[model samples]
Target: MYRIMIADDEPMIRKGLQKLIQQSGQPIASLRLAENGIDALNQIRESCPDFLFTDIRMPKMDGLELCRHTAELDPDIQIVVVSGYNDFEYAQRCLSYGVKEYLLKPISKKTVEAALEKLVYLHSKHTSPAFVSVHRLEEWVGEAEAAIWSLNHETLVKVVQQARVEISSHRLRLHQLIDLLDEFTVLLFKRLHSRDIFLFTERAPLHAADDEDSAWSQFQARLVLFFDELRMKRRGKLKDPVEEAKLYIEAHLAEEVSLEDVAERIGLNASYFSQLFKQSTRETFVQYRTRRRMEKAKKLLAQPHYRITDISGEVGYADHPHFTKTFKKYAGCLPSEYRNKLGIDR
Candidate 1:
């Protein structure tokens, strides 16, 4: 499915084009209209549509400049220019920017169809690539660590969706796919451990499922839950030096938050602060923090909008697997199960 946008100064022209495109029964997944180049540009930035149609003359920004800006922002987007002028210079200028079709003012269904045929062919040629390679998948997992940790739901969902697509396309054996998921989960754990965050939970043993679909579904669900608790180990409150340390931890949950770092921030000896935190909270600083994180995680899990990965980082665990494990230990159920018990649709 391809998304398309049309930008024109004339309201009638824009509505006509939209109607024509819909009536043509083309493979257009969606069609949007913008009154002028500025609105069109904003839409392009937000949706990054695969196709665009614009008039040569418009208020605020002309079609030529829109073409230039679109080329810079998304060179892959196919563009068709509609103009009243048949000037050769306009044609040459549009050609220089890789505009797909140059239609005259009196546009017809036949001409639009001809332009769409070319655009569809180009779109096909551009999008027939296979799944992402394993190397690239690893790179994305590493790059997504921060978003996964910070509870950035938008970025996290995008990355997870990409990974899901790649995994589905690979068609690996059930065991092989499980191994891949395990490897990725381990990478997340390694990232968290590097920051001295410790995590423990009952490892849900993987069985030989009948098919890859079951395993993949289970794995992704677990990962979603794991991500939900990533930052649980960093949220909490305390007294005096411990209170200051807790505040510091809350403010820096997305960073490499460490006991030493917080202790230093509060002008307390790290060793003494550790003992003091345990005495004050009846749990070690880490345990206290994890408990607080679990509390926050429970609240976030109740909301359908929060991704588990984002919640994991929000509470401060970067390694999603570890976050999941520790969350289960604290909450006595997997995050997803917790969400279900709360009668929420995840």
Candidate 2:
């Protein structure tokens, strides 16, 4: 079990962090907490952890000082900053000190899950001497050892990166790799919403390849084609609770929402709604909602009157970095890329 240490000045914050770390999939062998930096330092000398999560500011010894001193105690210990947006600049300073993740306060469960997921992913990816097998690659991609469905950005990055690494390493012969990857991405996508009707499509001609790279490249090209088709096919279209839920989302674009809230609005159970929504849309409700919001966000940003942060919050992202990641995923570029293109590149 991976050990975790959580530190914060506030009792409630520490309590919440403890709960989140427990739920984050990194099982607690021993969890030590401190009210401030000095207490944390004293504890670290006795018991070192694989990871340390600390708030930036506190009464006697703030998180920054704790993070710095903790590293001097154990440079190998991974650190993630848990603080407010105002503390981010200070958090950045901790990076030179060796912090792994910069977490913001008003912490979401998703954010915590993402952080632990990375540590878990890193631990497994680097330590296991096991050869990358077709089945094992898929298995690693799906590890829930903690709940990851609601997580975003970094968690998603870890998942996608693991998938990319296991698949892209030229681990198999070119033709075989393509066939394996072609099947893998397809199954992963379809499995999420397997209960719904799937519009089947033709697969790429793997047998056509006389060489490895050509075959793999052809397969990747086809995969891209298939996703583009899938996206276009699903975009702005509605079925099941999908249409009603999306209408609700679009209508309440600026307000706070939860899975339960959306379910209640449509008089459907959250589990059933989540599954069916993913089934029909080939994306989770959160993903679909974010995609739509980003679509609107891009349009709004293209206009002269909108402020980026205000638009970010309006679209349901409390953090601009979160919004930026969501924007880049759907648009295949950054917001500033779009902005700069309009101002001068055009």
Indicate which candidate wins on TM-score.
1
- Name the regions of candidate 2 deviating beyond 4 angstroms: 124-346
**What range of 10 consecutive residues in model 1 has the weakest lDDT sum?**
198-207
Per-candidate TM equals 0.44, 0.36
Query: Roughly what TM-score does model 1 have, to 2 decimal places?
Result: 0.44
- The C-alpha lDDT values of all candidates are 0.75, 0.68
* Residues 1-346 of candidate 2: C-alpha lDDT, one tens digit per residue: 6778888889999998899888876677888888888888777765567788888878788887888887776666788888786655685698989888888778899999998888777755643542357677567535421112333335544654565565566444333355565665566455434535444344433444545556545544444443433443455333345677888889887776777899888766576567556655778877777778888888878876677777788787888898888888888888778777778332
Q: Which stretches of candidate 1 lie over 4 Å from their true place?
A: 130-346
Using lDDT, give the best candidate's number.
1
Per the 3 Å backbone cut-off, how many clashing residue pairs does candidate 1 have? 17
* Residue-level lDDT for 309 in candidate 2: 74
Given candidate 1, what's the lDDT at residue 59? 97
